[model samples]
Target: MTPTQATAARRSKISPERAQELYAAVLDELREHGYEALTMEGVAARACCGKSTLYRQWRTKPQLVAAALRAHRRGTLAAVDTGTLAGDLREAARIAAGTSGRDTRLTQALGLAVLSDEELQAALREALVEPELAAFGAMVQRAADRGEIAAGHPALEFLPAQLMGVLRIRPVLEGRYADAAYMERFVDASVLPALGLAPAP
Candidate 1:
């Protein structure tokens, strides 16, 4: 079977009950201990399951963390319904920045872990970055279909970075709220125009 199908099969083998339990335990461990300290042993201990069970499914801590990220993927990208590019992007930025803001701990921790391991970085991108960007890309495509932006817009794929970057840097640079409103202003001033939308008010 293909890799994804194999993953699906293994996931299916995991009783929904046990799967959620394992995932929850792992996330809690991440929240408390940070990524480097998060181990399969730790997760299995907290999950009250054997380490083999986690290893059978994930093989490594990076894989386990990557899966956990997939399980908890959320924010504006998850429910974007705005018909207009500007509106959609504003919400997208607001949501994308979420992980970098109050939930900043996880993002920061992941950043450190990824930098230390190229393989883990790839897996992290697959689990975290690619999915979110793909979701946002669909919105960008829809905007192009509506003539709000160019499909050929060079900055299209970089939308995720633009949205998340500001938030990650805001605390370091300005020490302010990168809230929905802040994200909105971002959409109006920088992102929208970059995608060829009209400048913000």
Candidate 2:
């Protein structure tokens, strides 16, 4: 379609506020039914919009859900500066444990599907993984600058894997979501020792 036609089409449909409301429905559907089982019709029904509206906005379920994911993306760990690497890591662990349980479930739900679906994988990376990775990298770099860790410390290098691994696995292992207290314990018992540092005094 022509640019004017596209603009007209978009203008004729839902408001941005309305679209935001619909995106919530999309995510809820994804959480409830998973990616493979989610349908455009289901999202529309939940959003109380016409299926044609969604189809007009996004030609396929993947595109619509990708948009929803992007719309819902937020800063996962954008403001975590605790003055010391150990302090920061402990704080990070706490944040991850509290916030990541649902994300872990979502990732598990999308597991093998993400591997085979390029669009879905890209959406997942952009919406979920990249922000947290950037935050973790910045946290580590700040720690190095502050002399909390060696520039080439092994723990610094492996920190992301360690934290993310525990976040993903804890639910499976114990049939319980990791919580702040559990994360603090993990930091004290494991992360601090790996970094060759004692817990904060």
The best candidate in terms of lDDT: 2
C-alpha lDDT values of all predictions: 0.76, 0.78
lDDT per residue (tens digit) for residues 128-160 in model 1: 777777878788778778887778878887787
Model 2: CA > 4 A from native: 1-20, 51-75
- TM-score for predicted model 1 compared with the true structure: 0.84
Runs in model 1 lying further than 4 Å from the true structure:
76-79, 97-102, 199-201
Model 2 agreement with the true structure over 1-201: per-residue lDDT tens digits: 964366347745778898898888988998888888999899999989899988887666766776676566443576888888888888888778766675677667665778899977766675566777898888888978888788788667777888888877888899887788888888899989988989975
| TM value for model 2 | 0.79
Q: How does candidate 2 score on lDDT?
A: 0.78
lDDT of 1 at 15: 88
Candidate 1: clashing pairs of residues: none
